[model samples]
Target: MIPYTLPEVLRLVWSLVWQQIVQHAQVVAWSLFRRHHQAVAQVYHYKRRLALNTS
Candidate 1:
């Protein structure tokens, strides 16, 4: 039987952690982007409604 060295195990763990970090970052970025888009759309809609009321 063969055994993995300590360095090999550490490397594997590091790779998994890095992958998780990248995935979480992408999720957070998309969430923020979506929130920003929704906020902008709401502002535009509010402004349009206000203008219509004034006219």
Candidate 2:
């Protein structure tokens, strides 16, 4: 087994942790964007229906 120095070990761990954080963040952002898009579409449809009813 290759012995890693302290800094090297820390760097390896940090990279792994950072990758996990970035992946989690991407997933969260995508979900939020999808939800917001759905909400906007719903609102647009509701407004269109209201306009049709009024006119």
lDDT of 2 by residue, 12-52 (tens): 98888765555888999999999999999999999999999
Kindly list the per-residue Cα lDDT of model 1 for residues 1-55, writing each as its tens digit: 6899999989998888765555888999999999999999999999999999999
> Ten consecutive residues with minimal summed lDDT in candidate 1?
16-25
**Cα lDDT, model 2, residue 55:** 100
TM-scores of the models, in the order given: 0.59, 0.55
For candidate 2, give the lDDT. Answer: 0.92
**For candidate 2, which ten residues in a row score worst on lDDT?**
16-25
Residue pair clashes in candidate 1: none
